[model samples]
Target: MEVMQKCCVLFKPDTESKEMSGDSLLEVQRAKRAANLRESLFQILSGLYGIMIVILGAVIPITEIFMSEEIDSTFEGFYIYLYSVSILFLVYVYAYLLRRNRLKTELLTRTLSRSLSSSRAWAKGLARPDTDTKSKFRKRMISLDVSNHHTGTFYLRLGVLGFGIGSMIHSGLNFGSFVSVSGGDCSEPVQWVKPLIHLMFTFFQLYFIFMNSKMCIHRYKKLARFGLVHMCSTNICVWFRSIVVETLHVIHHSDTRGHHGAESGHHPASDNSTHARSYPHSAVGHGISHHGSPGPEYVIHDEGMEKTLVDNMSHVHHISRKLLAASVNASGNISSASKDNCHWKNMMSQAVEEAGPYLYPCTIEYSLMCAGILYIMWTNVGKRPRRPTRSELETDSEDDGVEDEQRAQRMSVDCTSSSRGLFLGILLMVGTIISIIAFYMLVNQEEMQDSAIFLTHMSGTFIYTVTLLALLLAAARMKNLSFHNQQEANLEDILILISYTGLLVFIIFSLIASILAETSTMSTLTILSNVSMLLQATVQTIFMLAGDRMFAATEKQVRKKPGREFITFLLISNFAMWAINTFQTQTPQHNPIQVDFYGPEAWAIFTHISVPLGIYYRFHSTVCFSNIWKNAWKKRKHA
Candidate 1:
């Protein structure tokens, strides 16, 4: 009887080992299949990236040169080319997304049918010995575990991007109207098409992103990778194009301002003599000459008209000699200008040009937002979902329960705890706004320009210094808090580090220029601002690193956390800095010291490239700080 019991136990051990071996074999097969898919996906992605780089490398410079050469001769055809290509790319992506969604629906329907059939078979007891294995294999083939993890960018950022796209559409329509009415060499069909297509693309693309920004693609992995990567590359190209166009516009404006200044300086007496006489004729001539080639037959030889043209030569110098002659003739017939009326066209052109500076930043920001979202999507393609362990599942449920309890209790923000920081932040914001207003108002005046630039640097220096000190104090207070390191770095952390490099580049360049240039008020201010920004960025990064590791403290220990107020203050301050950088600092006039030191072309390129990233850092930092503030004081769960 004892031998018989022993034999039964030995048989039980053998059966258990067999079952474990089968499961291990299945897992190994699944891993091998995933590895194979990953290898193929990578190869395809590398090929796509290589192709895009080659195409952009060959196309951008050629298009730029063509546009530069044609600028004086004709209205911009570059915009037409740009919008047409963007429209094509957007249309392709739109189609793919729709088709992919449809296919996924069909696949899901088929999977449900199979699952139902198998359930019925089991209910009837018609299932075979291997039925479970076959069903599991089929499920793996038909469905994937999908994850929708937060990518750190908040909906507020998306709102900002939408605002920017709307601004761009408005600007584009104004530009299209100006071109269409001016009756220049710009094609009639193309004039309206650019803005209309831009409007359509933005509407659809924004909708798609809002819907699917967090979706991780698990099926059709190859096609998903290609489409996502294409979208990312296209957005990056758009960003690059925006920066180039903005830089060129700034340089052109500076040249115009410099020429106007030179003329005003050299002939202060002539301005009084011809102020009234030349005003009307020059305005008429500018309107006519800006549109198209006015024929020589339109020239009239009136003495007053000729004098008006000569007095305003600096403004009309870019116009061809034929156009100059035509403008002289048009000025004589200014009273009878009904035949070639341009009043409406002139007003629209002026409005469009005036709005460009404000609207350009929006488009730049939009491109960057799209690029970041698309890049995240690209990385998420084919990402396998991780299965949580039993312990993790329990922890998550407990946390959710805690959150529900807090919500039921009607928990509210602890404003009293952060009152000092909030008040100080408000004051700093008010002072920064005042400085920005003063700088903008005085920047164009020749005598006040230097002082305006100095004021800008000084205000920036003060903000950076204050923020740096606050961050340091917060770090010191939080140094002893209990926390744990993340097992792996996430995409948000990687992106923040990458964005910080952009600001670092700008700071290093500024420091080098300041050190190299002769000592002056502006240079001294630059050095101070650069040092403060560098230190602020470093300390802020450390704070973010520390914040991520921090475990929520108990209510009793919450008072010791100490950085919530500082975090609130830093958030508002960073936002204030973002606004200042976007609207004021990016302008070439505001950075005369860098322009003078690096020369116009080099400086323009440097700022256009780095400033956008710096702006993004400030904007992104606000989001990060807001997250820290929200999570820093949550109640810790005790084991």
Candidate 2:
């Protein structure tokens, strides 16, 4: 019998005559009122925060373009719509918190600590002693992906709890919203945005410190598995904390699928075409819910159903969507055209090829980047007690040779980037410091309105865009579809031109936005530090895209390699900024007097672009997988 000491669970084969009964599991899985109380406090604060984010996200745009007459101060009127959205989101969040807490307390086990029924195992009646440990080929074909830890789940949950709350309030009249740069009535942070942001950010700050903070008890060499590191300050600690939280998020997602059938009043959608309004496909904001061992399964029989999941995933470009479809198809619940699609097969191969190692670096870099997020004045969690190894932290820009492939094919991996990122960042600083000079040199210096300035903006934006394209081109030259795919007989190449143009635009637009914002010349950059902001907006997106593909590739079958799609999203969103231009100030103003007053308005909607929809998504995520969540919780509780 398997005795899981750490898990605190015992193993037994039959549940029919067990020490713990199924009723006990239900009791273990029941939600608790005490936890509901905790959730209530969180909701009151986060609800307010959600209201604020709704303002920032929703109101600002409306005020900018439609209600331009009320703009006398900062974060003005941003609360009107923000409050509304916050109320709605806060309600949902609080309810969810209540449900989840209940689940935590009452979780139970179905059978034992070990011995899963094998899908492909032969009749056990005549079985002899088995010595071979070789994993079956079919197992590889059916298993869902559990790699990459639970970064997305943990991070998003924390983010939803933290930024979801803070951003909401920041958008509202909350204290987290703004300051009086000009000392005007509205310039001081609004009262509305205050409580929410404070409560959420307080939690954020606390967790940011606790997780990343290390007390140096001992230091081991690079490969030492166990030891301690000490953190005494908050400098660069936000980044450390945020990244650690994010990493744990990934672990949580991978550990168990999110709770399936999570809905207040909705039932799981039967087909792939329609989506749940609450959870959507996966969790909101790319919260993935995986089934089986691998991500998406390639059911080889049906065509229409297979395409349904694939197309949905294609539309979103998220890892979990595709994984879900694959899982469903593999389980024979959907069509099988997916397995027949040549391009889809090729994409799966290429994704595996590139992503296998790319994920390591992304995790490393993302954690290191967290330093900027912990912008509080208290502690420095990222501080190294001793030298961390390249393997331990692929975060350092200096580290190379992370993998031992050493083969010529592998040796030529050109992950080498411009290395000019720092220098270019410096240029942005110089321009910002001497922005007055920059303003003076302009034809409409006093007005801050120049058509030529727009041209320069467009041109500079173009150059940055062109450079992004160049890298993509080099990457394409480096590799191609490797699975020797069989192109679908019915497949016709879509508008290749549109696809390429759309992709290039995404990479460039965000790249430049970030570059222009980092004029702050402080040793400690704010969490929204100019460079860090730029990285978050542009570099982080790129990393997430890469991370998704790398993570998805571990499965037996894949739909499309997502590297190219990542490039496309960048281009499209960049092009989308034109919508903001509709309200660019015509008169001279130091900065555009853009403001909003409400939540759930247009801008608020825009901020929620990446937020997923569907009851399934709210409950079932790619990680913290919903399918196993019930059992895992039950097992833990009954243990």
Clash number for candidate 1: 1
CA-only RMSD, every prediction: 12.6, 27.3
| TM-score for each predicted model, relative to the true structure | 0.68, 0.26
> What's the residue-level lDDT of 60 in candidate 2?
38
**lDDT tens per residue, model 1, 387-491:** 433322222221222344464442333576677788889899899899989998998788998889888888998899899999988877666666756435544
**Per-residue alpha-carbon lDDT of model 2 for 121-234, expressed as tens digits?**
211311331444223312221111111121222323332343233322222222212221223222333432433443343344334323322221111111111001111111
Q: Count the backbone clashes (under 3 Å) in each candidate.
A: 1, 118
The lDDT per prediction is 0.58, 0.27
Model 1 TM-score on a 0 to 1 scale: 0.68
